[model samples]
Target: MFNSIGIPGLIIILVIILILFGPSKLPKLGRSIGESMKNFKDSTKDIMDDDEINQDEKATKENK
Candidate 1:
């Protein structure tokens, strides 16, 4: 979907964002976005690990 938005499009979008949010808030915005992404990744990883553990337990029970 985002394949069409190449370098020029990205630059334009960045410029628009900079204009709207200004330079001063950019760092805070980036930091918040990074933190949000990290939290999302961690939660997903935990969920996947739990799913794997459940599957393993079920497999062991079936074998028994």
Candidate 2:
């Protein structure tokens, strides 16, 4: 989707966001977005780890 949105496109989007949200709100908005991204990343990692553990358990049982 964003494959075509290069540096200029990103700059334009940022400018628009700044205009809409203003400088003061930008920091708060950025912090919230960062936190959300971190949470999403952690959740995905936990899910992947669970899948690996389950696969390992299945393999061990099959070997026995």
Best by TM-score: 1
What overall lDDT goes with each candidate model? 0.98, 0.97
Per-residue alpha-carbon lDDT of model 2 for 1-64, expressed as tens digits?
8789988999999999999999999999989999999999999999999999999999999999
Winning model by lDDT: 1
Q: After superposition, how far is residue 64 of candidate 1 from its true place, in Å?
A: 1.0
lDDT for model 1 comes to: 0.98
The stretch of ten residues in a row with the least summed lDDT in candidate 1 is: 1-10
* Candidate 1 C-alpha error for residue 21, in Å: 0.8
Off by over 4 Å in 2: 1-3
Per-residue lDDT tens digits for candidate 1, residues 1-64, read: 6689998999999999999999999999999999999999999999999999999999999999
Q: Local error of candidate 1 at 9, Å?
A: 0.7
Candidate 1, residue 47: CA error in Å?
0.4
* True-vs-predicted CA distance for residue 60, candidate 2, Å: 0.7
TM values, all candidates: 0.91, 0.83
